[model samples]
Target chain A: MSILKIDGVSKRYANHTALDNVSFSIPAGCIFGLLGPNGAGKTSLIRIITQITGADEGEIYFRGERLKPDHIKEMGYLPEERGLYKKMKVGEQLLYLAQLKGLSKAEATARIKTWIDRFEIREWLGKNIEDLSKGMQQKVQFIATVLHEPSLIILDEPFSGFDPINANLIKDEILRLRDNGATIIFSTHRMESVEELCDHISLINRSKKVLDGPVREIKDAYKTDTFQIIGNGHLMITSPDFEVLEQHENHGVFRANVRILNQAKPNDLLRYLIDRVEVHSFVELVPSINDIFIRKVKETHHA
Target chain B: MRKIWLIIQREYLTRVRKKSFIIMTLLTPLLLAAFMILPGLLMTMSGDEETVMVLDESGLFEGKLEDKKDLKFVPIAGSLEQAKTLYQETDYTALLYIPKISIEDPKGITVYGKKNTSLQTQMRLENALEKEIENQRFMASGLDRETLDKIEANVKLNTINLSSEGEKDNNAMITSAAGVVAAIIIYFFIFLYGVQIMRGVIEEKTNRIVEVIISSVKPFQLMMGKIIGIAAVGLTQFLLWIVLSFVAVTAVSAAFGIDAAPTPMEQLEAGRVAAEGKSVDVINEEKGEATQAEADEFANTIQDVTQSFANLPLLLILGCFLFYFLGGYLLYGSLFGAIGAAVDNETDTQQFMMPITIPLVISFIMSYSVVLKNPDGPVAFWMSIIPFTSPIVMMVRVPFGVPAWELLLSMALLVLGFIFTTWLAARIYRVGILMYGKKINYKELSKWLFYRV
Candidate 1:
């Protein structure tokens, strides 16, 4: 079942239409990547689901029921532009945010202490946000976002400012939260994280959804029916069944891309390559989400 | 409701705990207390009387010099050198040497002092000599002191206001002062606390926490919570000031056995008793007698204040003051909050501030300049009725005896105006707080106002 289902969602500003009749659903217990380039209505759609804004024309359902303000307690959002009260202490800010999300003071305090200990940021609890480093502040903000243990979490550009180590830490946390039965809507233009983390994604472009499906399904749909073969020497193939798309000879090593035509099979190509040169490896070339994102956006641009 | 309450609590607690708040709350009372005792302290600066030895070579003015307040003259029948030695031996402030010169061309009078004498003492000595010489010349010209004293005419104008009740003593000075004071306080508080609301909005917006906050609670909730919180803070500070000042003054007065000075309102009764039908005592209002009753006048001044206050409608003015204080803050606080949401920083607040503050500024300027001068005129009447200006203009007009119907109408309209501005501000605030880096203008604001939220 979908954790969030948005139907016929449309949002328009004075100068432009931010989201144009966008329709998608985020299934329960899955990591859903909300993919789009900058200004492609990704934030607008997330805002609608979070109820930070209202859809001009749409219906939204949460947990098989219509979405309402009470559902806010069941959701956690970390916006693209991360911020905390600069003058407020880390512990106070966390508890305040937790309470705002409908947690009681004692409950918020307990959850905050747990998160602070888990993040190893207990030393920063008493310090003002302005006194902490950017990375440390991000840590506290992350704790604030998830302290209520919300079932559905929305993080926009969650790793934008993270260093490699901290990004990995957040990446691990995101996966862990999803495995713990929290449906995650990870919004970003960074396609690599999507490829690694998302099981399903809906790509938006120019205020419209250009692509939507499971990550592997979308990748399979964009495949070019090509295979990359790495062997000892360059193969000079003259067969009409298998077309040599490209071949490069690097220091007596042969790397070639070949597309199988009709009346040919992958096993047959493997047999032919083995007969010709010593076979090292043969794998079908699947498109990356990054390539799919660029191609879809460009296609929409041109259309 | 709970969320809004939480927000208010946070806002109030954070501000009340600030160092500046605590410091200001404590310092103002002490300052007021110090000011109350400032005159007494000045008197005690040289508590003992200082003696001045006069070496009179001009035997014509032998033993005529008299003692002044805090100044005594001792005539020494000796040379200037002996008088200088006398001044050095004793703690005499100064020694005056008058040469044998005619009254027509009096000169060569020198004051010798062990130390530089105070300006007050020197002025008093000079005045006494001038007066004595004038008297001697007048007597020589065949005019006695009694006749000259009678020739001095004194005019003490007492303004009596006639009303339907009857003719009564009216102190224009006291009433006008009350009006100006009320206008100034309203003007000052609106700006002081209005900017606080604005800066708080800007802070949340700039810090980017506004987004998180609005997500959890409605924008209107946050705005109201902040406005109410800051108002509470302002009230807390004011209440603390009043309570602390009252307690401190009462304690000091009890300890020192000194009566507190009269408030402006209380001075009206003193005006009535001290000024009305007192022409028989006009002859004693001379320079010499004026200097003698220094302490008596202070007590009399306090009495005048107490009576003047008794004459005015104290309960009505105070009740109206409290109402307008809160009403004015609410009215301007919401608008200031809206401006804070619209702009990214304080520098961008100028354009929006102009329209919101213009009426307040105009009312403040006219409340004293025009309304006080002509309290019953059309300008004062209209200004007092319009809610935007009424907080100050009505306050200025109230002490000058506003009609009951007009007061009620102005108050009712003020309530409606505050409600309307708050609703308008909430609309703009909900949308503007979410916008980032957008150059918001009046047109954009109007658009946000109409957006179907």
Candidate 2:
């Protein structure tokens, strides 16, 4: 069953439509990627779901019940414009925020201690938040947001500031949390991350959902029948069943790029290349998620 | 309720724990003491060793000034022109020129001196000439020296009563002192804490921390908690100030061989007698030959001033102060909170802040002159009863011994005012905290006040 369902949500700001008839759903306990380039309605949809901004058009449901103000307690949102009180101590600030999210002091402290130790920022407990590095502050904010153990987490560009190592750490943690039955709406333009983490993906363009489905399915639907044939030397093959799109020689080996005709299998193209020369390998070059995302956005713009 | 308490506790603990608050709490009394007593201390420390040359041309008389240990009188044997030259030649403190005084014109006496000459020097010279003429007349008359001495010791007939309970409550001085104290407390709390709320709001708004905080709590709750927390801190600091000031004044006076605290009866007697058209100078004198019976009568007529402080309708003063302080703060604090929420930055707050701050300033100014004159009169009564000015004007009136009905009325009105203002402010707060990019104006704020949640 879907955990969250947004139906016909629309948000207008003066002359501009922030989100136009945006609708999507998140399956229970899966990482759902909401991907779009800058100025897309990803943020608007996220805000509407979190109830930070009201939708102009339709209704949202959490666990089949209509979303209400108090339902926010069950969801964790880490907003894009990150901030913490500069003068407050890191530990105090985290505990306060955690308690606000409905955790008791002892529970918050215990959870905070575990996270702080995990982040190895135990010495930073007594220091003011302003004194911490930006990356460290972001980590603290992340810990505070998730410490209450909300069932659903909404993270907008959560890895924007972290270094490679920290990014992988957060990515791993996100996957672990999802594995532990927490459904997360991961919003970002980083398709590489979407490719790795998301089970289902939705791409928004210009305040509308342009394409959405299972990550592998969408990629497969947009795939072109292109393949590269590797052989001993450069060989030209002309057949009605297959077309040698290009040929290039690298060092002593020759590579032939080809596209199959309608209903022609890769084995047929491989057989055609084998008769012409010694064929080493035949590999189909499926488009990556990034290529598909860019192609879809461009197509939508042109259309 | 728990969230509100959490917010309030955080605000109070965080601010009160700051080094600035602790330092300010310690510094206020020392600064006040210095302001009040610095001039007197400086004067005494100067060791009065200045020489002055006197050229009394209008000297309706001469040799009338008594010599004192601090000042040496030098009667220069030279003309006005020669005295000017002598004055320039010597490092005289000042050259006094007492213009001629005609018997037909007693007010025509004038004294001139260099710019550097102190007013004390001029006053001393004038007293000398005036006394010499009086002494000459007394001697010329057939009056004996003993009779003249008795006449010189004569004092004005003054009666004083400290209690306001009597129908002929004659002690205006005690009332005046009460008015001053009341006005001061009102002035101190209103602005001291009102600005604190404004600045606190501005700080959170500017830092954009309000975004994170507002997400968890309602804007109204946040604002109420902040204002109340700061007020609690202000009250704590004020209580400390009163105690520390008392301790410090007592300690310093004790160290300097002075009576630190005046007896209640002594102060009341002084205030009451001063109210009855008597010079306090008479009370200051250590010795006088007034008859014991007359002295006893003089002392008995005046009620003690300590009765004013002690018998000060305790519940009344407390009720008035608390109501005025809380009401005034909440009423103004709501506006400040609205301003803080409406504006994206401090600079933007200035536009909205002026209108809210003006009434407070006016209340402060009114409490000083008009309110102090007659706390129960039409002007004071109306101003104190009004919501915006009541916090200050009412507190000012309390010291002057306000009637119970008026005090109760003012407190009720102030509380009602806070309720109305808080309701209005919360509406604006809801819209403003989330608003960004656009500059807010009074018209927009008014519109926000009427907007449905």
* Per-model chain A TM: 0.96, 0.93
Please give the range of 10 consecutive residues that has the lowest summed lDDT in model 2 chain B.
Answer: B284-293
lDDT of 2 at B367: 72
- Give candidate 2 misplaced runs (Cα > 4 Å): A228-232, A235-237, A241-258, A277-284, A288-303, B36-192, B259-314, B366-386, B396-413, B442-453
Candidate 2 per-residue lDDT, tens place, A273-303, comes to: 6777887888888888778878987887798
TM values, all candidates: 0.89, 0.78
Q: Which stretches of candidate 1 lie over 4 Å from their true place?
A: A297-303, B34-40, B46-48, B56-69, B88-90, B97-117, B126-169, B246-298
Q: After superposition, how far is residue A262 of candidate 1 from its true place, in Å?
A: 2.5
Task: Report the lDDT tens digits of candidate 2 across residue range B1-453.
Answer: 888888888889998999999999988877765554555456555536656566666665567555554565676766778878877777666766655665445564444455655667666656665656666666767665567766755454333445557633334566667656766676667667776776777677655566566656667778889888988898899888988776666555455533323334345756677567565455444213233445444544443444445545557777666766677878887777777778777777767767777877887787767877766689888998888888877777776666778777877888888898888878888777767788777888888775543
The TM-score of candidate 2's chain A against the true chain A comes to 0.93
